[model samples]
Target: MPPLRTAFDALARLRDARAFHPKGARVDGELTTLDAGPWPLPAGSAQVAARLSKGAGVPDGFRDVLGLAVRVPLETGPWDLTFSTIGSLTRILPFPARGWCDASYSSLAPYRVGGQLRWLLARAARDQPKVDASLRAARRLVRGGGFELVLSSATAIGVPQPIARLRLHTVCDDAGQPTFDPMLNHPPGVTLYPDWLTKARELAYAGSRAGRA
Candidate 1:
């Protein structure tokens, strides 16, 4: 069988076995808009299904990963976007005390701006004396439309440029089991980089599926 098909089969078996929900404290949010930009994107709203959990199953309140799975309707069809707090572009994992608001998201293993990639990361508020202060500032930004989503180079550190902004309307009940396959569920113009990291991810996804199955 083809490698792609083999990977899909593994993911399918995992789904059938009901084994995809080991981590992530799921939450609900709204994808209000694309946040006006140069790129051509349909103006529509979609539900944001997200998961907040530690990257290494560490203790709560430690450095964690925020997973966002969005399915947006477009002229072509449904466009799905899957991103993580710790961007794949970066090799270093963020420190635990960095907090969620300070986390970042990226697309493509190698970062590039204006390349059909939507990256999100929070910048620390200047002059904040404490971590809590920064967290509060981040929270306020999200609440007040100050949180910006931009297309730019993915960095292990530094603020992401603003291309779009997300305002989380509410937190809904978790979806019992949610599965996201970038290979099967990406937007029309977006694609994974042809790189070893992408291949590794495919294998990891297949392995996770098989393990769950």
Candidate 2:
């Protein structure tokens, strides 16, 4: 995986930002657990730090894949849930999104939650406004009321069930934002499965950190 790491490092250095989702806005948020599907998310609210970005960094007025990284301070540790707009459930490919509304997101890979493989998803809540694909819009959107998302968890052959509501609060500067990495910062019972995939993902993030740091 040395070549993969090197390639990611080069890409990050070339862009002068993250290897992927180079441009983004940071936001302070809160996650309210509602009849949760997993432990640690059962019956309480948690302070959340999040990043919203475009996967390809496409310019405004254009469609691009959207990304969201949410960090919740769990009792076990910080859990980062990163999501991206996916085209389909077959292979979980990345798809372009027009804006904040109607954009679908998924973790792309299953995680072992309570000894069962689960897919996490997020979508704009029904009472959302039309927020465009730009950093400024994200800032304005959050300041106004922010994006309310319906958190969902699904099994391999089952439908995604609504588990919680994640509400973004205020915009924050990126200067002090933590590099969200679930591979290293996940809680005790939540684990990324399929060893090879995790290793590759970890290496990519490591390279990004080294390049962007």
Best model per TM-score: 2
The RMSD of every model to the true structure, in order and in angstroms, is 6.7, 1.7
TM-score of each: 0.58, 0.93
Query: After aligning candidate 1 to the native by TM-score, how far in Å is the CA of 202 from where it should be?
Result: 1.5
Top lDDT prediction, candidate number: 2
Q: Model 2: what TM-score?
A: 0.93
- Which stretches of candidate 1 lie above 4 Å from their native place? 1-21, 34-40, 75-77, 86-97, 108-160
Worst 10 residues of 2 by lDDT: 85-94
lDDT of 1: 0.46
Look at candidate 2 and give me any clashing residue pairs: none
Compared with the true structure, what per-residue lDDT tens digits does model 2 show for residues 41-98? 7368888899998888988888888889999887677888899887654426778877
Among all windows of 10 consecutive residues in model 1, the one with the lowest summed lDDT is 126-135
